[model samples]
Target: MSEVQDSGGEKKKGKKIRAKKHSTHIDMTPMVDLAFLLLTFFLFTTTLSKPKAMPLIMPDVNEVPDPSKQTPVDDEDAMTIILSKNNRVFYYFGIKEPKVEQASFDATKPNSLRKVIIEKKKECESRLKVGGKTPNERHKVVILIKADKDAKYKNMVDVLDEMNINDVPVYAIVDITPKEIEMISGL
Candidate 1:
């Protein structure tokens, strides 16, 4: 409830008359109820933010997979990429006795990692015998990524971005080996 009251009282003739004063009262219960209702309405109607994540698809364990869809990759078809300190990248084409050649993350240069992966992808795709099978069934590039202890996490993220950019079909983040560490230590 709101109310207004006049403060003027009877004045004596010899005394100066005082200015009239008015008092106001405002009830805040309805305003508070309205504010809470608006807050609750907005809270219930708004959607909460979702967590960001990278996707990882795993095979269904219960369902039997058809063997026709699977194509085995040769050892020669494998490509290994190693991430070292300072965002450096080392790549080799095969599994055994890899030359351990260094490639830059730079996109502008000819020997950049993207160029190498794209070239290797094309080569492996060419080597697959897609005789009667559909194009998707053909063998694709398989990349193995390993990171050194000294390597920065950003390098791994960059390599993952490259994989996504090139649409690489098969790849895994494998653990680094001591032998591989020795190979790149001098470089």
Candidate 2:
């Protein structure tokens, strides 16, 4: 808002009548109040986005482990993924003598890591008992993640992200044995 005020000064040297000088004043209190009001309005109306987190369930430390009574994962439903140096990924199904196969993280490739994860998950799900009506009732696919000492941390994170993106139910990060390191050393 603006207002015009009489300066209350008359020129003595002027021969003819002239317009009187007026000073202009602008009141900024209302503008400041309106800005604060809008700021508060927006602050009250909007909801902040929650942070994203990867869900990981760990076994209780107090529970005594019984190896014999533990549920055994079927060979068909078990997939082991290994992260190696230079962004190398290797995976093999089952615990028996594994035939390690190289995989790529590139989505554009035919044999991308994401595609492999999805395919393995489907394969495991297909073998589920027929009586189970829903995905929860069926057996979960077990994925074991192992990273070599020389493997980059980013590669491991990428592998975990792939597992999450593909919805692989049961995945665990395990220590890589020296033998496994030797297995991928040549690659």
Candidate 3:
């Protein structure tokens, strides 16, 4: 077999130099532009939903007691405050069914619940005093709060501040059932 040789003594092997048959070069400019466009689209168009929040730690389902066997809070000094989505404030003496109180709130004027809670605390204290007991009596002032999921966070905070100011320490955050929460959320 005969081999072709260059002037510099390099062997010219195989057929004459041929152009590549199937070049697979990709232009990254368009791809990189598309990636940046997608990133900008996500950054501008995405809407983050508000996070769910609560002050008190919620009880786990496993730790929750049986609803049917739950003892009623019959203590007259016990108070349950419910903040409905319609901005209504209900005060319950001892049961879950809270009585709607004619409470007013001004969004411009903050801490509006303070006055109402002060009055309610006075009334509760007076009732306990008439019953030959002081305000500091153990479990004499339980203030449970049941707040609507859509209720303003500020309102719940105001209620908590009022309870703290009134010295009603014992409190719990009532949780709604899954069904009730679904209904409230219109899901």
Residue-level lDDT tens digits of model 2 in 134-164? 7666666799999987789888778888877
Give the per-residue lDDT digits (tens) of candidate 3, residues 35-153: 99999999999888868654565556687688898645546657666666767555546554434443545533443555655655666655534345655642345677777666777
Clashes of each: 0, 0, 0
- Tens-digit lDDT string for candidate 1 (48-118): 99776777654567888888997666677789999999889999888766888999999988889999999
Better of 1 and 3 by TM-score: 1
Per the 3 Å backbone cut-off, how many clashing residue pairs does candidate 2 have?
0
- Candidate 3: lDDT of 81? 66
lDDT of 3 at 134: 56
Off by over 4 Å in 3: 1-73, 96-98, 106-112, 126-139, 176-187
lDDT of 1 at 12: 43
Could you give me the TM-score of model 1 versus the true structure?
0.62
Candidate 3 lDDT (Cα, 0 to 1): 0.60
Error of 1 at 107 (Å): 0.7
lDDT of each: 0.84, 0.81, 0.60
Error of 2 at 109 (Å): 1.4
Comparing 1 and 3 by lDDT, which wins? 1
